[model samples]
Target: MRNSTLLLAIASAMLLQAAPAVAQNNVPIRKIKAVKPTTELTLLDRVESDTHKKIYQYNEYGYITSVMEYNKEAEQWVLNTDNSYRQEYVFNAAGQCTARTAFNVDKAGNKTTEKNKAKVEVIGDTTWERYYKEYPDSTTHISEAYAYDKWGNRVEEILYGYDGYNRMEFIRSYKKREYSGPVDIYADNANYTSIERGRLLYDLTAKGQDDYHYTMNTNDLYVDEFRKVVWQTENDKLYAREYGCNRSLEITVGSIEREMWKSSEREFILNADGTRPVRETIRSYDETGEVMGDNISHSYTWDNLGRLLSNIRYKGTSSEISYKDEYTYADDYAKKLSLREAIAELSCGNQIYPEDEFLQFGRIATSSYNYVADGDKGESTYEWNANGQLIGGTWTETCTQSGPDNDNPTTVTDRGEIRVGYNADGHMAWKIDHSITESDFSKIEYIYNKEGVWTSEVEYSGDSWDGPWTKEGEWGNARARKRLATRAATTPKFIDDLTDGSHSIEKHDGVWNTYGNYNVTDGVVTGGGYQQTLISTASVPANPAYNYTDPLMPLEREEDEDAEVASEEMWYYYWNTDKGDWELDWGPTDAQRVYENDGNIVADIYDRNQTIVSTITYRLDDDGRLIEETYSKGGNITYEYLPGTNYLLESVETAADNSRNVCHYYYSKHNYVDPTGIESIKRNDASTPVWYDLQGRRITTPTSKGIYIVNGKKVMVH
Candidate 1:
């Protein structure tokens, strides 16, 4: 998804840079001697612990050649080995930086150097700067070259990358510029080379005039995948702009070129001044270019200050609104005037504080509504001080609503409010959160060190503001002890059930259950027991009494077909020795998922006897899109998509009752739907994996190590 606002802003920046330059006053230069702690202490009274020294080496031309950082150790200055690195620079006769290097130092006083050096060459109107790595081998494999016309306008720019074996490949190139009167034209090309995808090329062309600008981008592999944008200005101010794109797949099989499928056209209308989009409309069409659905429109409005005021999206061309958002700002002129007067009087004979200079002319309230059976809505309001700091806020959400069975639909509302207080130095001192849904209020008091750094906080819970407050937690240094105590308290205890001659344990984290006939020794289960695990499935049978109708399909192990699919709950059971049959153990738990690299679910196991309860098989097309799914009990579902695209055209489901259900989808013309972007699953090799809770909420930093969803797979962190 490309952001229209961001693209417009980038275009505006390019326009500003292309305009004539204006002379400005020279900026003052300052050198730092040391980085000191923030405290109310005189410089002479500060000890070595309060500051770290910085050393600088300058050449005769006043250029810094080297910089060194040192921290106080044992009452003496020493190099900051932790995270600190040494930087050195080399300059040519023209005072241009020619080489730069950084050295990493370990606690054992070992230094490893890495260097990047550049060479400059000038010939006529062209200038070349070649960069090379000075480690392993000094190869001039990367270089940037630029050429300017006689009028000092850049005509060409090229970036080259080494191809490993020999020669340099064109990573990016911008060449062939033509200027005629007030119109300028140029082309930009980018080449991406990969072993699997071969070479993919992208080309862009732009035409700019005094009052109009146009740009078009196209991909060579998919000729039909192109985007075009146009901007028009009036009286030197942007009046309107339009953006549209086409998404399609083009493949060459032997000598035949096939156009599998293409999406309909989608267009956007920009508001005056071109700061934001005014409206967006999408039309849908089938593969044969036949209209499928009515045109859909989403309109938006903004205030003079560029703040969004309202957004309404309609389903098709109907009056039924699908989504809406409204915003309100603090625009009380009288109140603003009074605040200005008070500030002026306070600063009559003194300078105003920097933190209090700005007035709170920000959003005060916002409301959002989504289409549902009844109505789903959320509203929030904020309070800010003259310093533009948020002091308080309130939020309310209608979580659920009764169906339209009665005359009056009832709604369940969840409300919450927050109050914040700041310290004398503008740092946050405390915060309080009152939640009606939780029936209690929580408060956190921040603790800052003498250096104005936040080190810890104390949390308290209470029913009301005037009542006694109970300390719930103390974070920072004390949190480790609390975590250890909690872990110790939650240590699983296995108890022997003499009646059944089995071992049982209380549920921990709501996932584990009792294991029949299992022996526990030193917190470890060693004896034979019925084990259970989750397996991913495309669909679950409507009737739990389903019986196998065919031989279980073997799990696919093809490496090229390995991919991720949607997850679902798993079913588990344990063997009952007395009954001589499988019995339900715990549950059809919702969090169960199977992690397999083969991208197929063969059969789901029900008990220790390895009873194949139900087998579900999935079939995918060459492009790795799901096309068919089969169930063990003769029920099946088939999916049909537009050729070469992930956009489903129709789906048919056949139930055991001999009933068939069909569904069809539609889209607007020129709507850019990138199947690759939406369906492609990349392998996760990221060092820092993103964590999400079972409810699908992202956790920026998990407070405790436990089971979490990482890269769409359940992961247990110890």
Candidate 2:
């Protein structure tokens, strides 16, 4: 649905104002040359973006005959072959959109040329076609086509795919066609209005063997409205329930499937002004309403200056364990630094690491850094170059450890060492590390791009001179691509939003299969109820597009319910005094959600009984940046403060293990099994939290030796 009236104008203006000036000034101008009155949009702006660069398509009736991508960099466009566009219709009469084609293009225009095509056909008032192809290995690559009724309502799509074969396979035979029911289609004319209901089904099969079915129910509520979903298996097993707040926030709930009605609750907290979620929380319970301990909570932090800070997460029995981050600088905020500077700043050539270890022990090699004033204790011992890169350093423990070997030794073991290295382009181009026990040494080398992007690197283990060598970076990227492509072919689609009252219900007799396309057959009922089966084909669309919006259950939906809510425990949430509202600390509660007239979340607050516990304030950064969240818990305000390039930096906790404070300030441990009173711990500990790279790789090592800084160069001195 689209915004209406003054709201639309305001939204457009805001969007335009926030977009890049180069982008805003160069909207792709579409030139349509229609022969006469036609139902289809002749000139389709396939890919719309800034600099007027996008894919454009010319269609005869519903069949697209030409497709091209306008390369703004080249100041021209390249047209795909006619076969690249799928179209159905050989009408000798006046051109009416009889069919449309499905096609794909290399978005990046890489050298590996791949062709894209789809089938298009018409049956009754609803036009239907198929996009099909069999690879050289006989692997099926067919997707059932879809089209709306005369009203332009999308109806069906059949999906088919190749089966059981590795990348090395040379010959793979394809199976028979799969079938699915006609999908429900949704339509919403304006924002603030109700949604349009739609449905679609997926028939998945291997070769001629039919095995699984995926059905979808979708609803497009008018502008910023809630979308609900209920997914069921072919056997009518309730799979999941999901509530989507606008297009951004989504709450997914898993089915019980246990002795009792068990379910897991997940909420996605998105950027206030956009659809990107910055935080996600999941909660689960077992039979008898007892917390089964599979709960998870995740939060993302960003600096006031708009850099990502760190992501904090809690799960299962370790829900109370919190994490922190700290960053180093190789240069001023503007100009990028060399890999040598980047690595040297951390006193090492390597930095990113797993978040779990960093949360438990803020260690860089064997040494954990303590920040006291500007040059106190652990702070001054670590030497840095003129570029703020660490060259030489000594390691020391800030907080005392308890228990037989520290109350409860974490899963991570501390390996101590001092790192010495050269930083180049915010990456460690070269370094040497020295270890305590073995008197061992490790060296590193890096490669980067003209844009200062790190490309590849190598590490040698043994003496600083040379020994066993290992390589990383580009190799990893190649492996990742293959895995991603395979996963896309195998993952099942979410089929919620069907049972909710937001959409209409429909049943058709067709064997549903999922792979690439659907193979429809008119058949009699093979079974009934949850296992109701279609005995024949041709009764429904071979491929159906499912779009249904189901209603969320009380426990799943954050909306207020008429059911009586009884509370047993009391907790304190933060209230942002300046913003004039209470903030939710953990996740959504019944009393927290409220919507504005335009369907945007206006205000949300968390409370323990009638007393407010915390307040959350949301605002946009400069240039209409995504919504930034600030937390105010127990009247103590903390903004997103990150000091590192790889990880979001936060205050280090003062626990025995050099971990963050896990306990909530307002909650007391009365019968706690794992009592870790880390919240009250001080922040001046000499432990330097570890940082994880963009790909979730651990880069920092903690030890007793401070970061090694040699002259103005930083290095990892083992």
Candidate 3:
């Protein structure tokens, strides 16, 4: 494991060094136009509606500096604009802006800024932590302190708050923990202490918790968490990660392993293949401590291109197995893996034994993936401007793999073509994906509001942009096309009222129905559309009255509650009837509905006699978000996002044992927005989606539910 981590650390350093560098004179500044690479042409311009200001700026070299927002207070919409946050920039010799900084701003309009400098530092990138002190009058004083660890990780931050009388109110501290390895784990803790008039107040202490983690893995991971088992190699190599928990595990159960491999400067050592190390096989290194090719044990060899040619494996009893692998690269630098050969040369005693059930009984099996490069396959290249904007590309997939058929031994050919275009503001204007059958052209168009928010998107799969294609459904004539097209760009307006239409009440049978607009504005959506009826609701346990003895109290006295029980029925009937049903049994109501003076749904009511046995109130937030919900009989559960962030902080379970357990959550930027305090969940709280620029293809996902990318091109990891 140590060897694996060391190798990965060295590899990451190399990759970082090879990344594109910003010119020394190019200090990154803010830009109003979406930043773009030099090679691509932008087709759209971003216009700000709030300020009614539009501007575009770039580095001297024409590279985009930033996509900026303007504020009325600033008076001008500049690349490096100001808001509650401060912004700064650096430009290179060609005057190309490289690095920019964003930090909280003070009332003085001053900020603490850092330059990216486009240096792409292979190591030692530092972070700055800013502290703020707010007075009772609502004014804040900004101060910053820097503390970092050996690994260039930030560790702690502190700030103070005061009251209107200039008396200290409290102190806030942010602390972090970072571990060193191929993977890094970070945890944050925040503490607040009360202060009065520049002195300590109350007990003077408050506490909070937070955590973050990152990893550099060689074995590709589908999910970020470590619970999943992606695959186990024949050599017993395994790797896994868990998304929500931000945990990962890697193990090399193999005997012989690759180590100390640094392509640059060619640093490596050769050892005889086995579990134990032997002195005779100990390879030597040169004066620079670099293991030279000459020091390689006879067991390994390399090709002229510096690729590993073959590796020898020992199987004891003077037997050996040799494996070789090779790779070929495309013009664009995409590489293909080809297995050269697997030769097992063995010398064993002449004996026959029945096949093991694990292998022959079909309980377990082996599988291999094969790749054959297509030589005659037409090759294509894509070009994007210097702004990292795509001009075009030779989008094609030619090679195919043949494997076992369980679900179905199938060969998938990438048959569709994609073309992307950008707007003048450097935002994606449209993306066209050609149909596999080559009959229709499928496309998705994005329209961004002045605020840079993507307001609407229209998808079409048709032979052409002309008539005879289904919009959402149904083919349309010219007039229909015009109407649909107009509506396609925007959502329909809400009907003001249904008063003029109809307001009728009818009761033919036992069932009575009333239909009418409930408000003058915003027509009531009813019946088939939204019946606004109850599905089910949670409720308190049957028994209600009891001594409710404190478990912490003396055991002899704890039985007093049972002695006081009026009746067995009284002990069991604790139901809150007003709320229709328990929240879990049915569902929570809209927060807006609760805020608008509607009756709060507490819980379901059950009765053999209905004598007010018991009641339970599931806690709810102002936004109608469920807080700590409890089963009054005994158990209680609470769901909430962590503080200062929208990520699911934890789901806690409280039980009769007087003990509580928690399930924590961590999230990648996708599928989640940074939320402050308790979040308001409108619909799906379990699954939130965000978008990803997967090598330039916009893939929208929470991805947890499951996503198919490129029609079997790959299954997205949750």
Give Cα-based local distance difference scores for all models: 0.41, 0.30, 0.30
Which candidate's lDDT is highest?
1
What does candidate 2 score in Cα RMSD to the true structure? 34.7
Residue by residue across 461-517, what tens digits does model 1's lDDT show? 777854366555211225444544656444332323333334643222212232334
Q: How far does residue 202 in candidate 3 sit from its true spot (Å)?
A: 34
TM-scores of all predicted structures: 0.34, 0.24, 0.24
Question: Candidate 2 at residue 165, lDDT?
Answer: 50
- The residue ranges of model 2 lying beyond 4 angstroms of the native Cα positions read 1-130, 133-282, 286-290, 294-433, 436-438, 443-459, 465-718
Question: Clashes in each model (backbone N, CA, C under 3 Å)?
Answer: 13, 154, 64
Candidates in order: C-alpha RMSD to true structure: 28.6, 34.7, 29.4
lDDT of 3 by residue, 1-718 (tens): 0111212322221121221111111221212122333232221123232233223222212322232333345675443233233233454555433343434434443444421121111125444433343334545544333333444433333333344464333333322233221111111100101101111111111112111111112121122211111211223221111111212323221210221122212112322332211111223344345654533221444333223333343332133332222222222321122211110011111101111111111111121112223221323344445554444443344443445654433454455555777676666677666645455677666656434544455565667644233433223245444644566343222222345333322111111111222122234323211112221222221111111111110101001111242212211111123532111222222211111113334553334332223334456556444455555466565656545432234445566566665443332221112222332322233232322222212233433444322211233443
Q: How far in Å is the alpha carbon of 636 misplaced in model 3?
A: 46
